[model samples]
Target: MTHAELVFVPILGRGHIVSMVEMAKLLVGRDPRLSVTVLIMKLPFDSDFDSYTSSLAASVDTARIRFVHLTCENTDAEISSASFLTNFIEGSKPHVKRAVAELVDSAGSTRRLAGFVLDAFCSTLIDLANEFGVPSYVFFTSSAAFLGLMLHLQSLQDEHHVNIAEFKDSAGELDFPSFTNLLPTKILPSIVLTKESVRSFLEHAKRMRETKGIIVNTFDELEPHAVRSLAGLGAPAVYPVGPILSLDGETKKKADGSCGGDDIMEWLEKQPPSSVVFLCFGSRGSFGEEQVKEMACALERSGHRFLWSLRQPPPQKGQIEVPHDYADPTEVLPEGFLHRTAGLGKVIGWAPQTAILAHPAIGGFVSHCGWNSTLESIWFGMPVATWPLYAEQQFNAFQLVVELGLATEIKMDYRRDFRMESGVMTADVIEGGIRKLMEEAGGERRKKVKEASEKSRKALMEGGSSYLSLGRLIEDILNNMPLT
Candidate 1:
């Protein structure tokens, strides 16, 4: 029997890399005849995935799933615009081409080239796939709803000549086929309002149409309307094979062990069931001292048990802004705030989010509305108070609050870039949102999230929606294998 290998090119970010790798694992695990070769593109700055990749390589079967790290020249140039990602990926074209050629030559007739699974940011690599005479599929790391919005916005620009930048100033709601409710302009991703970023996203959306299919990291049940709308659109076939999370916690567990793992779990164990609220932004989420003070005041006033992951914004290395643990969180936090909320609140530098959410004590989450965090919150049946900061997080927050009614709103339009000018969320607003999350809307949101959690798990089981979709995707890959 001839073996087949699908080449996966994932973005360098932790969330994207982990999710795509999990998808690759699922594919190879489901079919013994198939294998996956993930082309790891290292970012110019330190992304700190060395341990993760090393651990994963050791744990997985290398024969079936292997990681090929691509070498690119390092640049110390500062990345101030959104085009950096596009430019970096474009620059790696020659490296990608060389890697693919080497893989083809090494396989000879023993294994056939199946196809290319491109990350959302790497859509430009589709042309490379075309040159290699293999089908290309996009592994979109965000929600299906966001995917629909991207395509819709692209069409609006291409066909209708509608300017998305105008939405920044307009106080109007736009209707998109992907969502059931009217979307307010305020909730549009901050990137869409900027010329360069919008151009980059639109270009990605345009090229994504050239792929054989677009695989979204979402399940049908979670975003039914968005998933259904994609089918009617004229774009390529869409496969919703997800909630694809790295549930094993291998990478995080290692990090957690070094960072007072016992202390966090021990504190949680002491709290009463469903009483403590967890306030964690995504990995990149952090705030200025002004905002941090307000959050501390709010958590104190709310009189609820809490776990806050307060991180300091690391100095800009390149384009990416990673948040690091503060040497002393009290430096940024309010005076005597830690002492005041000592028993009720535990403010830590880094948190084991999934582990915390899984604990019985976690009642609700104050989250950044990042797709991975959103899915994890749902998986653990935790109601969320959306506090989106950057990227597509504002839109994700809106989808959860207004479109799906699964999350309560903290501040849907808050963006990191415009944080100072956007005005600090007052202590009262923060307190009210936390109260609403843990008390008022908690029951209904918990019920819905619990239901979604159950369906999400079932979706991966045999005979489930995601299972069938993955099977279909694999069949497509097998059928598209090049003849030797």
Candidate 2:
């Protein structure tokens, strides 16, 4: 009997892990001989998982997938600190090397590791694949446009115009032809400025450039310029297979609580198209109490119907209270605002985001600009209001707002130098942006968003760009390896 091909290891982060998991699902669905083992920090369950997470967990189990947790504690500090980001970049190769070594040691002679697929950030795993005599494929989750930006950044640093720990605004445009406008040095990934950051990026990019093949979560038609540029890199053959989630059916299991049953789909079904705004900050982004209250006020005042997913606030000594000015408006809001905008909004501690976005009632999204969120929104034919919080989000926002022509930038206090500490955007700015999106009839911003939504739908249909790419990816995988 032929053995199943197992894909082990993932870059630690919600967005990275989610995209990689979708790729594994694609491989398994294409052939009976394939199977996948996902090594994550934690599985999608506890003794009692929430409805959304539980549904995700059940979907994995139904697919006959294997789960392995490295049990590494992904601390908040580890995710946020520039020092930690640096360490992760520097240590990723060694970390993957050790993890794969452990996997090989634990597997008996009967179980073969087969081929390995890893994230672009996991550069060291390529060497491990070489040692194990398995083909290695690098998976880049961001759009091709961002990859082009990274390549350009490498060139700029090579010329010594920019250095680590020192990045002045480059008034001139970026030299890359694929770029639509002058690419400022400010929007580049943090790991490209300093010598240490540059070295880390170079190490990983070299591995990717030298690897045998690569897969990008993008469709060819959507980014032909950037895609052609990457294809010219000459080392790895780039395959664009994307809109993966749209190809996969929803596998939500029903949730039963003592009060009643809650169906996320039903909630979405009850809303109107382009009327319900869905808000979700990526998993790692957090805000102070002040920012949270301001966000709530903006949503309430925008006069738009909405669904917001918020994290549980950190514990304070007494009950946390909104400022009196906000509280006096409406109780459903801070203290009294719900009565004013009754039935216009619902702010849950958390919502099933994917389910909500895929709903017919959801016309637009307020997103943190995580790549996964960007892809999901496009797949659902929904427009976005880009509010990037951190990391690659700024780059993602640029792609959405400037390159893709699908979203508007939520003007925040982020400086030209990209510092976040000294600024806090006020409720007025937030309210103004939302008001334009929801109410300003015939506004240019609204018209652009609507057009993008229609285009995205056409892109995912039969023979459409995303659909054809998915077929090509499956064909490549299935034909390359025979079922036993």
Task: For residue 261, give model 2's deviation from the true position in Å.
Answer: 9.4
Error of model 2, residue 394, in angstroms = 1.7
Clash count per candidate: 0, 9
Worst 10 residues of 1 by lDDT: 250-259
Estimate the overall C-alpha local distance difference test score of candidate 2. 0.61
lDDT of 1 by residue, 1-484 (tens): 6788889999887778878888888888899889889998887665566765777677675478888989864544345556677778887888899999999999866788888999988999999898989999999999998999999999998889988877888899999989999999888887788865787888889999999999999999999989989865556989999888877653245444564556789899999998998999877788878999999999999999999999887675223556888889889888998888887889987787888889999888999998989888878878899998878899999999988878999889887753213668899999999999888643776788889889889988899999999999989988888876
Model 1, position 297: C-alpha lDDT score: 90
Q: Please name the candidate that would achieve the greatest TM-score relative to the true structure.
A: 1
Question: Which parts of model 1 have CA positions greater than 4 angstroms off?
Answer: 59-62, 75-77, 250-260, 316-319, 418-421
lDDT scores in order: 0.84, 0.61
